[model samples]
Target: MNTLRIQTRDGRRTDISADTLATLTATLRGRLLTEDAPGYDAARRIWNGMIDRKPALIARCLGASDVVAAVNFAREHELLFSIRGAGHNIAGTAVADGGLMIDLIEMQGIRVDPEARRVWVQPGTTWADVDRETQLHGLVVPGGIVSTTGVSGFTLGGGFGWLTRKWGYTVDLLRSVELVTPDGQFLNVTAESHPDLFWALCGGGGNFGVVTGYEFDAKPLGPTVMAGIVFYSFERAVDLLRHFREITGNAPNELACLFAVRTAPAAPFIPEEQHGKLIVGIAMNYAGPLDDAMRYVDQIRNFDAEPIVDLIRPQQFMEHQKFLDAGQPYGRNYYWKSDFFDRIDDELIDVAVDHWAQITSPLSSSLIMHLGGAGQARPLDSTAVGFRNTEFVFNMQSAWDGDAGSEEHIGWARAMFDAVHPYSGGSSYINFQTEDEGDERVRQSYPAEIYERLVEVKDRYDPTNMFCFNKNIQPSAAVLRRQRADTSPVSD
Candidate 1:
């Protein structure tokens, strides 16, 4: 009489027999855990604290085969399911209420081929794991700044990081990805093989299937590079912002900088008195010659506006990758509203600082990131990550603790985005958006033609749209037509 209560995507309830569950668990090389099992609560948790969902069961996948088995089991049961890679997605997509969850945390394995400048990465691995291994050969795979973010989601969602100016988004370097589609079939997709699916995976999030591994065309980089931070008083916020623009405007491809208006945290480098004070500064990393890297930030380094503290210097590649980790601790409620920018003019600066002035939570901050260089050189058709022409990106990143004050924090982020919406180019980064933004924003972020193409690919691989989560892309018109044709009354 050991039955599991489960909910389907259509909001129907069903019970799974203990015998059926045992059979599925036996098929997997991995173990299956029920809600009452040890570690089930922890396994169901994700990065964003606001997401507190409990799946009825967790299938902790050990390898690609385990993923395939889990997918088939869930599909057979018609159980609502979610795929958890690193469990770092801000949308809390890793788990759904009373559903089945395929957890990939146990599958972190990385193989680096330095000579070929390629790396084979399993989905559960993080950027930190890749950097630790890739840096051993003086090679780098362009990844997100937060080292904890999983490789699969970030790369598939168009990853951009400190090295983007010098190299490109992580997807640009992708050679192939191994995925288990909604049909429970494992297919290795690349630009040459299954080009359409490959295109969709470049930035389409998790609509088509569950990705198991990725093969990347990694680039040679540094074990040590010139990278660091500088903090300035908010009194000179405008001047500091102006300097930031000038520095990144015509900057060399080897330099990538991030400017922000944040309340100074109590770090050793920041003065005790300045802690909690509104401030502005730029965090920079140089992927070029060490000497040139030194000369790169010299202007701002010696500016008359004066930096309250400057820590820019040559450091290990690893240090800069996780530079912002402190501010983005796990279990904190997080919300981010983002936009694309053609330039950072005076008006935009004023708008950003105004929002910064009204920030209710000390953890909330505004980020202006420089875009372009080698990444811009790539053709628009090279991948699905459109809007490569933009010169900048705006992010109003908000983080607040506990539920009591969540509204106040999210309100600040939304208001800030609205104030600067007119300045935006009518597009945004999909990965930075919250789940509430929904399908419309997902469709609007890409060109109409590009989005339609994504739908077509979704139609081809997952006609029923089983993977309908995480900034989902619905199946195209053709898929609906075929489904109707198959189900319609037929004459003899």
Candidate 2:
């Protein structure tokens, strides 16, 4: 190891001697990587190819002990650090430029207690990992639609997926979390234990601490589910979407559906002639009995114009989780803008359709997910997740091959976001927010009271703002004042 220049918590640069770096390396059970390290390049890369940050050091944590060592080292040195799970966040907040990168990707572990209907997952575990284990017993944890999404970041940022309507947001199923605080204390947090901290962890983002493990109350779902996509011609999108809004409004809790507009991909299920043509798709998952699911499928099939492709069928739950994974592969250039909507009205549909026509990239898409069932039944203040009354979420995803057309694709997504924002309920999904959507946009993710409460928790647990990499919530003035007033040294 050599001397390294790293960023500090106060936005200043400082150098650490080789001996100091060696001390940190020796304390870790996992390997530590510097810029010159053989695998450093691949270690720092995240899901979004648009992000190209170079961290000064990377700690590949293997377990809770390694996390504690890394946290203590960073705290003692007053170093700025970011945490990486599966690196699936669109904002690319998992990697910090010229700072310590706590790489948790190697800590994937999951234990399922099927009889108790619960599971404990490591921070690095992806939804696919959890699904693989839980599905053996016909159980599942509410997780993201993409199989590769990290369990920790997704649940902390308010997870939504095909099972959301039936099981509620992922946070709603959380039983407890084992966390390493900024000051180096490891504690198991739960609603019955540290109620305030536990509440903040639910949709509060990663402002408070580094989560080592998550315990969730799993639901009995299936080894097989009736789930797939039904694609329609773009010409009939307006009529089809209006009908989509009607049926979804009355959709049962067991039926979860999402509407999307994008170019058709070349797949066996899609006709070769329709390849590259723009279309609207209604993707659905019915978690109940097979016979009951077909009735809702009939409603979608009854639209005036015939569907260009209807591939709805019985599929393994794990297979359904990977349905959209191909389109959002790692290293793709992705930018997104999103908001919550109370209704999918005519005016909102018109704005969405107009923006859909100007999509700059074939891989880009506009999506509206119907989102009011079991999730909405929870009280608004029950957890850090607000906007429970939200009927749908609108996400404009801009994706392209490389940097040449970055501006054009991002512009299309922004234009559509600005146009459809009028129909929004003045809140947003934190996970879908892009890197450039500044602090004010993050504030928009929660209600006024909820944001204030999150700040309080952040102040209490992370007074110095050590974890400012994610959708950050700064500490209160009083907390900083107390820290400055006390001249006592920080304990390791």
- Using lDDT as the measure, the top candidate is 2
Per model, state how many residue pairs clash. 0, 0
What's the C-alpha lDDT at position 2 in model 1?
A: 81
- lDDT against the true structure, each candidate: 0.86, 0.90
Model 1 clash pairs are: none
Tens-digit lDDT track of model 2 for 1-492: 677899998889999999998988889999999999999999999999999999999999999899999999999998999999889999999999999999999999899999999999998889999999999999999887889899989989878889888988899999999999988889999999999999999999888889999999999987889999888999998998998898898899999999988899897878898999899989999989988999999988888887888879999999999988888889989999888888888998888898899999999987888888999889998999976779898889999987798999999999998899888888877888889887888888889999999998987888878898888887887887888779678788
Residue 235 of model 1 has an lDDT of 87
lDDT of 2: 0.90
Q: Roughly what TM-score does model 2 have, to 2 decimal places? A: 0.97
Winning model by TM-score: 2
Model 1 Cα lDDT, one tens digit per residue, 65-150 = 99999989878887888888898877777788889988998899999988898999998899999999999999999998788888
**Candidate 1 TM-score, true structure as reference:** 0.97
